[model samples]
Target chain A: MVPLYWYLWLGSVVFAVGIFGFLTRRNIIIMFLSIELMLNGVNISLVALSHYMQDLRGQILVFFVIAVAAAEAAIGLAIIIAMFRNKATLHADEIAEMKG
Target chain B: MVEWFFGYLAGAVILLSILVVLSRNPVHSVLWMLLMFLHVAGLYLLLNAEFLAATQVIVYAGAILVLFLFVVMLLNLKEELRIKRFTGGWPFRLLIAAGILIILKKVLDGFKVGFKGPWSIEAIEQATHTKALGKVLFTEYILPFEIASLILLVAIIGAVFLAKKRLRT
Candidate 1:
């Protein structure tokens, strides 16, 4: 009914902001959030494109993306916790040493 | 009027997403991320992807984000949190973002793709995007899907191994 371009435009803006967040934030959790934002942005675009193209493929991809995102979240948060237990800091800059 | 509603919803979601990125408090950020997910789910509904909208809500808002919040609170990181800026300066960051926006505009402008009209909700109500998607995924994309699941299993085990010092003998 309304213009599809609007969704795409919004998606792109959100995605860009997410990119900026991912690049800028020094905190690992915040960076993880930026990643989530980026993923959400991509999902928005995928769903929008699927709707416009009358294709189901994009939606399917979103499904896979969500699954991967879940697995990523689990592994990432676990790693963050493990790191925090030893370093007592979550900031990316402070925890430079990966091995200890 | 409806278009205006959708526009506002989209804007709110984007704003919430920005808050998620900018908030210093991880708890707040996770909440904002949840709202963003909900807003995207609404967008999916608008796009006639009902099943996707539902799955998006259930998977992201209900599960993944909750896991994030749990981790944030479990660590009780508020005490040792660092209030650090993203980059050198906000103004400089904004300027760089603007430059990036301009470049993106230039890159995407030349690409001309024709738009097909929107699909009616009623037309898709019969078969449902979920059913159709399931059929396609199982029929055509079954192998990749299974592989992805296996990868996730491996990741799950790897996470356990990584987090725990040692496995039971």
Candidate 2:
């Protein structure tokens, strides 16, 4: 059986990559994808822990996390669409001004 | 065999995740994210979370990445593609990434196993993962489930409203 630490390591690497993307990427959609990446990383660790601990609670927590991730993605994409409509640019830097 | 499976899945997940971050085109990044999600589902299956694996495939790879692709297509980013886009200061991003990695490693290194519950693999195999999940989610976690549904409703309304045409602005 694979130990929990390995899974935890996998999750953390994914999270770190996501953080890097979130920080360095100028494209807003990519930034959103990075956020999803981080969420998935957390989901991995949670599920692994739940399995190793022989508990259902952590899996249940992952259920809620997936739900929240879905909600976040839907709303985030909608916001991206709206911002694109208003500003005609997807560059986070250029869209810095609140004004259209 | 299980170790090999986990190793491959972990490798693919990490590689695709890095690709999603490093790819120049947003569309490519979305596609890479799709592949990464699939690998993550495989990892979930390795953890005996078949239901979660299925959900990961269906919801994350199927629904969310498609939505990402849709938005990327809607944007028509030809000009955006021409310029290789990145925020200022390479070192800051590297610092942030390294910092997060170190923090996660430290936290997991010090991690303690908490109280084990009744949901052992044999118990879950008898009851089945999905059924057991549903039972607990519907009974003990009913309140949070309802809240999740409400949150989805809000998200639906918010998405529709935000993406809607102004009509008479």
Candidate 3:
């Protein structure tokens, strides 16, 4: 059997990549995708811990996390659309009109 | 054998995720993200979370990705393509990346492993993942489940309100 630490290590690597992408990428959409990646990393660890502990709660929490992620994507994309309409730009740096 | 399979799946997930971040075209990023989600769902299946795997595919790969693509297309694609894909300040990004690595190292160093609970492998196999999940989710987590529904409803309303085109006065 694969040890639990391997999964946790994988999760941490993926989460680090997500953070890197989120901080470095200029496109707002890519940044949002990075956020999703970070969430997936968390989900992986949650499921791994669930399996390791032989508990159902972690998996249940994963379910809730997925639900919340969906909700977040919906609202976030809508907000992105609204921003695009107003600013006509996708670059995060250029969208700082309110940065007085 | 299963360990090798897990290794390959995990590696593919990390690779596709990097591609999702690095791809220049927004459309390509969305596609890469779709593949990454599928791989993640596969990992969930390996972990014996069958229902979560199915939901991951349906909700993330199917619905959320399509939504991303729609918004990608709706935006000014030509303009988006003309701009630089990455931001300036590599030193700062590198600093943050190093900080994250340090944090991960610290967390993993002290990580504990293996605590048995009610749902052992044999018990879960006998009861089946979906059934086992449903029992606990409906009973122990029913309140949070209902709250999740409320949150989804709010999200729907918020999306509609935010995306609707305003009328001229």
Candidate 4:
């Protein structure tokens, strides 16, 4: 078996990339995708810890995380669509108007 | 052999995640994200979380990615293709990411895995990952599970409300 640290390192790297994308990307959808990436990163670590600790709770937590992520994606996309309808753009900076 | 498999899976996941973030076109990013999701499921399998592996694929790749594609197509992003790809201060953001990575590395280095639960790999395999998870989820974690369902219900209503067309003169 691979050392647990390997999985931790991998998760951290992916999370860093997600943070980078979320901060640097201008598109709302891409930012959302980056958030998914970050969530997956945390999922990796959760499963890794589950394996290391011989526990099933970590996996159960991951299952719930996936459920929440789905809900978030649905509502987030709807908001994106609503924003696009009102402002006619998907760029985060351009969608900054208060009264829409 | 197991180590090699894990290395390949982890590398693929990292590479695909990078591609998902860096792809100029949102459609391409979605595709890369699909691949990344698969790799994450593979990692879950490696960790013996078969149920989560399957859920990851079915929920994320199957349902969520399709929704993303629908939104991408609905938006008609031809004008967006001509705009600048990234936000300003990207270099500083990259530096911040690096700093976060370093901090996480230090934290992980000092971390110790001390907990030894009743469920071992052999025990879980014998009971089956899905069965064990369902037993705990429906019994011990039932309240949170129900709350999760409620959250999803709220999300459904919110999505519909947000996307509904207004009736106007």
lDDT of 4 at B5: 89
True contacts kept of 1: 0.55
Candidate 2 CAPRI grade: high
DockQ ranking, high to low: 4, 2, 3, 1
Q: Is candidate 2 or candidate 4 better by lDDT?
A: 4
Please give the lDDT score at residue B30 for candidate 2: 91
Query: DockQ numbers for every candidate?
Result: 0.57, 0.86, 0.81, 0.89
Candidate 1 local lDDT, A1-100, one digit each (tens): 7666677777778878887887787778888988888888788878887777776777889989999998999899889988888888877878656666
Tell me how far the alpha carbon of residue A21 in candidate 3 is from the true structure, in angstroms, after superposition.
Answer: 0.9
Q: Which stretches of candidate 3 lie over 4 Å from their true place?
A: none
Per candidate, native contacts kept equal 0.55, 0.90, 0.83, 0.91
TM-score of each: 0.90, 0.97, 0.96, 0.98
Provide the lowest-lDDT 10-residue window in model 2 chain B. Answer: B82-91
lDDT value for model 2: 0.91
Using lDDT as the measure, name the better of candidate 3 and candidate 4: 4
Rate residue B152 of model 3 by lDDT.
Answer: 99
Per-residue lDDT of model 1, residues B1-169, tens digit only: 7697798789898789889878878888889888888888888888888888889889889999998988888886765455665766656766676677677667656655456533334545666666777877899789989988997998799788767865459
B-chain TM-scores per prediction: 0.82, 0.96, 0.94, 0.97
